[model samples]
Target: MSLPVHLVPALDGVVVGSTVTVEGDEAHHAVAVRRLRVGESVVLTDGAGTSVTAEVASTGKRVFTAVAADVRRVAAPAPAVVVVQALPKGDRGELAVEVLTEVGVARVVPWAAARSVAVWKGERAAKSLAKWRSTAREAAKQARRPWFPEVDELASTADVVAMLSTASLAVVLHEEASVPLASLALPADGPLVVVVGPEGGLTEEEVAAFTAAGASSVRLGAEVLRTSTAGVAAVAALLARTPRWG
Candidate 1:
């Protein structure tokens, strides 16, 4: 099995034989929960493309120290994917974020779609956003990703249009679209954006606005998918055709 991975604030200048210390909640989980001890191997990453393989040297009440044995830096994948997911009711939002992060999405944008049933207001909005971000962080670690996906703040249709104006490829996941996702030619490099509507589906105006902003409306397949899983499925399909997954 792969060694347990812990996220650090920074991995810059980390070298073999150097000691790195982990503290706070991360260390507590390692020490108290995982029972990490001396001589055990682990991996530490900053989640921005740097990772180190290390062996535990010591443990404390709420902290642990490890000696770096190897360091690796990965280049960010080309043609990063950005998914704009409309809010789903209940805990489905967290599910979407978790799967998207595991699927290698570069960023997840929570969209306040017109037909969405869930509303993020005031404190609830902050908490929900935090939940999505926390979910992404945990999922990334579970997937052993050196780079974590970002969870963007709630956005409106207009906001999404402006955001994807420069994207090399953009697609709106509309069930009624004439084109299939597989039919589109994906860019080998640059930013790519995918827009997934809410449980109630997209408003006509919203679809038009996104299409006018350079996004092509495309259907994943003949069958409909839930709001929570549509983005993950679409992203998997798109990435399969890209070098990142090829």
Candidate 2:
């Protein structure tokens, strides 16, 4: 039978037959939120690809104990999918990060495109990036992801191009493009980076720069998608085509 899953980042390096105590946020979650009692079994994850099955030994207001019953190191999806998304205005960026995390993206790069409505600069940039990272962490836990995806700081179009150049395959989504995303043949291994432009889309010069860096322009479908939805759609399509999840 499948065991109950309870994601906790502090369970790293825990082995089967070892006894560990859950504290802080996790302790509160188990005792107050989940209302877990002694002798109940639950799965715990460290958000770094480590997972363990444990039985509750004791419960308290601030502390909880569990005896590890089994442990396994989960493998991440192959051909890591990285989403380079242009910053959208308002809460759109936050929504993008949360959905993409649930969609199993490996990394998120916040791009400051020329046509982007939202501009993250100075202290606002740092604070926004921190918020995105926190969102990613919480989303990963909610989705029960074995590994937490990273949320990078704001980057320029050129910086994004430089990073995508190192990947096995890099795709830039453009609605006006001739090539369809489904037509492209994905690599069996290595990394794939998908670049989604802002709501207004990329400038002619930005597209030229990415193409010059060996990034192929592809179209998702006939309908144009919002910046918040594009990355998640592309990731879902890629995952469906690849055997990474299997």
Candidate 3:
């Protein structure tokens, strides 16, 4: 049977027969909400490539214990892809993070691009970032990923430029770009970056800056996608050509 996966803070030095204790909100959800019971099988991951397959030993108000019978460590995905996503309006940003996590992107950087419809400031910025992180976390668990993707802090144009300068392959999804994303040769092992513009689209200045930082302006296809979806589409297309999918 496919065991239900849970997220733990860490699982270092875990081995067969080790008792693992899960606590706080994670335990609460599994014990109370999911009705996890003694002797039930589950897989627990640290989101850093370590997992323990264990049977629930006990449950409480906000805690649970499990006796591990198997442990696994996986290597992180190669050619880690980072998407610099322009913040979209409403809950679409969370949607973007959710799909990106499921699609196996390594990181999502929320960018406040020129002409972005939604703005993040003060308390809203913190709350919004938290929501994106939460979405990524849940999506990762649901996807059964050993290495969870990261949701980075809000990024400025200059920040994205700085990141692109060191990438092995960098591309920006633009409707009017001459080059197709599939036409480019990708790196086998290194950081790959894709920039997705906002609902209002990227300004010439923003495109120019990214290009100057070594990102290629590339098109996905003939049809234009929403800011919330363009990143995942571009990523899926790129992954199809990569060994990760092969």
Question: Residue-wise lDDT of candidate 1 within 28-127, one digit each (tens)?
Answer: 9999999998999999999999999999999999999999999999998877999999999999999999999999999999999999999999999999
- Per-model TM-score, in order, reads 0.98, 0.90, 0.99
Off by over 4 Å in 3: none
Q: Tell me the RMSD of model 2 versus the true structure.
A: 2.2
From the highest TM-score down, the ranking of the candidates is 3, 1, 2
- What Cα-based lDDT does every candidate model obtain? 0.93, 0.88, 0.94
TM-score of 2: 0.90
Q: What is the C-alpha RMSD of each candidate to the true structure, in Å?
A: 0.9, 2.2, 0.8
Clashes in each model (backbone N, CA, C under 3 Å)? Answer: 0, 0, 0
Residue 5's lDDT within candidate 1 is 93
Which tens-of-lDDT digit does each residue in 1-246 have in candidate 2?
A: 555566564775688888878788868877999799999998787777888889999999978889999888878778799999899999999999999999999999999999999989899999899989988987887787888898887888879989978889899999999999988898878689999999999999999999889899999999999999999999898888888655
